[model samples]
Target: MYKVIRKILFLLPPEEAHYVSLFLLQLICSTPFTRKLLRNFFEPVKVSPITIAGIHFRNPVGLAAGFDKNALHLRELSCLGFGHVEIGTVTPQPQRGNERPRLFRLPADNALINRMGFNNDGVVTIAKRLKYWREEVQPYVDLEKPLIIGGNIGKNKSTSNEEAWRDYEFCFERLHPWVDYFVVNVSSPNTPGLRALQDRSFLEKILTGLQKKNQEMKNPKPIFLKIAPDLEWIQVDEVIELVLAIGLDGLVVSNTTIRRDALLTPPNTVSRMGAGGLSGAPLKERNTSLLAYIHKKTNGKIPLIASGGIFTATDATEKFKAGASLVQVWTGFVYEGPAIAKNISAASPV
Candidate 1:
């Protein structure tokens, strides 16, 4: 059914097709009868819940960060059965991201290349939306388990690296009350100089500041660092050292990669897609290896939420075997249709 629908969607630009499909789903979900019908067909079978970082996830499958940039579709997305939905990469201030055609599809590689530049409705606005969901919508949702929400935060493009910690701190404070957990995203390739925040000196300042603030609160949220897959082993070691030093909650094993090697997509075709992070099947091996490396290095002390290349039960099972406590899907959700979370959760060992 999705294959046929996908063919028609494929005719439109990737970003256009994204909103159009979600809009349709939003309409379908607006009513009780249709929403229940949608849930009946798409929700995963009930499974034992798992605890990670002191939070309960009904299942291991979650929708990754970039899917719902703002907190706009939580009600509709919750009906699709993801155990958690990560929103943002939100900045302290809203900004229009890079130019159009920034998001591209690599069908041959079952991949997507996006240079979205952390575009979002900013922290304050999104925090308000989350507050409403927690106060109004969440209590009424009928489901076997509660849906967890994660805030994925980042700095604005105009913010200098020296002052970046302020941006992260601002978002951390505003969103702390509303989200279940927080992912500090410093690895997106699209934003200029953003990846530099991953450096030990810069990263330590930002993370330490956030942690200090977190401790001041009565109930602190779990905070995780999201890293790029392209990092060298030495860089990974630095990240591990910092995570241990700060007692950070966990790690979102990867963001997307800047490297485009070993792709089934033709060189000319991929080159046309230009400079954006590459995600999907090409990312599985390296991300899985990173998960194993970090799990071993930390002696399994640091929790891992695997992202990149997970499209099926086999892919998700590979993540669990590699030491991921939870898994997130972005490209997989786009390529696999609405049943992705249900399908993966139904078969996941975790």
Candidate 2:
């Protein structure tokens, strides 16, 4: 069924098809009856609930960040049976991001390449929408428990690296009240010099600053670092050092990769779509290996959320065996449709 729908959607431009699909989904899920029906479609057989970073999740399969940049579709998406929905790589202020044709489909590779830069509705606007969900919509849905929502935050593109901590700080403080957890997004390949924040000094400054502020709150949210898959083993070790030093909650094992190695897609075709993060099937091995390495390096002390290239229950089971406590999907969700979560959950071991 999804193959047919995807074939039709593929005829449209990638980004256009994305909005059209989401808009249609939003409309369909607007009604209580429709939402309920959609929710049960391919709903997973029960999987035991697990707690991660002090939050309860019905299952480990979650929609990754960037799929719902504005936090507008959590209610609708949650109904699709994801254990959680992470919203945004949202910035402190709104920005248009990279120019059009920024998103491309590599059907041959079963992947997507995007230079979307962190295009989003900004933290302030997003917070207002989340407030409504928490205050009004969630109770009405009346699920067994509140759906987990992680706020994935980043600095505005215009912000220089020197002052980037302020931008992360701004979003962190603003979203602290609305989200169940936070993910600092410094790994996006589209954002200029953004990955520099992964440096030890810069990371220490931003994470420690957020942690200090978190301590002041009546209730602080769990914060995780989203790193790029392109990092070296030495760089990853630095990340491990920082995670332990700051007592950070966990790590989202990876974002997308800037590398384009070993793809089934034609080189000329991929070169034509140049300079964006590549994500999907090609990412599975690197991401899973990184997950296992991190887990082993940290001696499984740091909780981890696996992201990148998870397209099936088997892929997810591999991540679990690699030491991921939770997992998220972006390209898989795009390629496999809403049932990706339910299918993976049903196949998950209790």
Question: Can you list the residue pairs that collide in candidate 1?
Answer: none
lDDT for model 1: 0.93
Cα lDDT tens digits, model 2, 1-350, are 99999989999999999999999999998888998898778456777678998999988889999999999888878888888889999899998889999999998898999999889988899999999989989988845766899999999999998899999999988888899999999999999999999999999999999999998899989999999999999999999999999999999989999999999888999999989999999999999999999999888999999998999989999999999999899998888987888889988763
What lDDT does candidate 2 reach at residue 10? 92
Candidate 2 ranges with C-alpha deviation above 4 Å? none
Which TM-score value belongs to model 2? 0.98
Winning model by lDDT: 1
TM-score of 1: 0.98
lDDT of 2 at 17: 92
